[model samples]
Target: MNQNETQWDKLLKIKTTGRDDSHSDQYRYPYEPTSYMVLERLANSGLIRKNNTLLDYGTGKGRVCFYLSYQTRCRAIGIEYDEAIYQKAIANKETAVAGNRSSFILCGAENYEVPVDVDRCYFFNPFSVEIFHTVLAKLYESYYEKPRELLLFFYYPSEDYISSLMTQEQLMFYDEIDTSDLFSGDDNRERIMIFKVI
Candidate 1:
């Protein structure tokens, strides 16, 4: 663990490991925890507020939800497709300071019903392009059902994700947080891509 992870673990009172992968064919991807550095940048962006409700897709161990909820004091909901990972997240949530306002649901992104009050969504390349499309449709439906300003945050977005996201007319590029300085290597593709939909 790095300095940030150690601090975060102490702060949240939970120990989590990154680069966790799964072999289950039903899962779209594995369990890789998002770096705390990227999340710190995202928190500093001020896109999330205390009133905003954030949905973290594929929330591995609920790190993003717990961190953001603690940092921004915003309500958070996490959806994890894997049962074991969901259990782990639940365990962590129990110890987090913002546990009362944070929830972790064990369900695939495709099946999750985007809450009407959810004004923010976080994606960290957790699923396939197909599942992303489905979730996008769900978001669209939820927005239309209860029209409200919403933001999508994608970190280290993949090319396929970019391509699929381009097809959505409602989402507009809002802002970005350049995270190149945080990493040592030149391949620091750490960018917090923000999109807005109203």
Candidate 2:
């Protein structure tokens, strides 16, 4: 963990400053927490509101759920497939500043059901494009059952993920949150892609 990550973890009263690639496979991605700086930018973007409920896929240690809920006052639900990592998230919630506004569930992203109140969703390439399609289907089902504004946020998306998302007729490109300046790399993928249900 770096100085910024440690400071943020200390401030949040949680321990989510590590990466775990042991569980990664062809379908499921590894556990990597989103940086505090990038999360701070997302929180200040004004896209998510207090009334909205955000669903986080592959929420390792529940960092996004805790940080976003704390910063935006929006209800957050984190879905984790790994039992051990899910336990860590549960532990973190016990002392998180926004614990009351956050919840965590242990289940595969493709099998998890999307709640109708979940207007915003966050993804960090948690799984392969095939599984993402299943999750997206669930989101669309929820949207169709209860028509409302639905926003999908993808940070550091891979080419496969972006291409599949672009072809989805139910979703339209909404906006982008650039984070290239925050890091030293000239990588073009250092940004968040925002899509809305159409």
Candidate 3:
């Protein structure tokens, strides 16, 4: 790897602790290296394609989008809710985009507008169910406005809520990847569920 790649990898390996309470004024944890490993695997396996548009909702520090863009040459955009973390993500985006690979926006996930032709959407347990539902509603509206293939990558997903929404919207499950080992302990089983519009 070159100097930029080396630095990117180093950033990916850094694990920032998340806030204890959901309501606390804190940023979400940065993704672990193993987490990126899983994302890389999915991309290599054709789950996330090259040259596709990717949206990382609640993207803290732009780690996922940065890695995806750097590795796959995919167009990536991240939306961060917290002001502090959003600024951090912006800084990270500048470093990653030294090669002009990625970009980010500082805004609430629910309030952000989905791009007209986004191919994939990513979420890493960004917020509460209420906010998730609102985002989904907007996504559904966008789909109706212009029908296209939408591949949703929900890491650390709320399966039950997703299932209900999928049923209501008639979306279909494409795959579910078990990424338990990405976390440190036995209980830290991270799951990535991929869904597509039916």
Candidate 4:
């Protein structure tokens, strides 16, 4: 990478937040500060246009979806597996929306049904490989039915697994945001990968 890119990666590392593995079945990781930057970049680049539907898989505290709605005019929906996290997401939505456009669901990604109109999806390392595959299968089915453009924003992505899934589905890389600095640790090399369905 160039010097500029190296600097950007370092900057992101300062804002990365480590994953919370406290709960066995609950994948409730807090949003990193760099996530806002990624959201803004996507919005500014016209990747997440106004009026488009956005789904935040495993949304904790609804931070990603809330920021999406607050920054842009996009309709946002968040799904959380943990009851406590779901409740927190609801509360956060209420405070952020103040009678605006946003919603939340208390369900796991595998069990949750994807909306017909959802055009964009966000996943912040929300699930294990098994659950991720399950959610991806649902998304593929939905794409086949609707035949609409779908954008996936995956933070701290598992590139190999995602690539395998993308082979069957028409997905192209849109952007990648380095996020190594957002957490407090020595290993700072996290990234957010954005993909667009063709």
Best of the candidates, lDDT: 2
lDDT pick, better of 1 and 4: 1
Residues 75-142 of candidate 3 have per-residue lDDT tens digits of 88888766777676666555554226567787877788788777788877776666777788778777
| Candidate 1 clashes between residue pairs 3 or more apart in a chain or in different chains | none
Question: Model 4, 77-183: lDDT tens per residue?
Answer: 88877786667666655456421667889887898878889999987667676677788888877888888888888766666446654664467877776666644
Please, what are the lDDT tens digits per residue for candidate 1 over residues 108-163?
Answer: 89999998999999998888888888999999999999999899999988888888
Weakest ten-residue segment in model 4 by summed lDDT? 9-18
Superposed model 1: Cα runs more than 4 Å off: 24-27
Native-structure RMSD, model 1: 1.5
TM-score, candidate number 2: 0.98
TM-score against truth, every candidate: 0.95, 0.98, 0.78, 0.74
RMSD of each: 1.5, 0.7, 4.7, 6.9
- What's the distance in Å from true for residue 197, model 4? 3.4
**Stretches of candidate 3 exceeding 4 Å from the true structure:** 1-8, 11-34, 97-99, 159-166, 181-189
Q: Give Cα distance to truth, residue 194, candidate 1, Å.
A: 0.9
Model 3's C-alpha root-mean-square deviation from the true structure amounts to 4.7
> RMSD of candidate 2 to the true fold?
0.7
Report how far off residue 153 is in candidate 4 (Å). 1.0
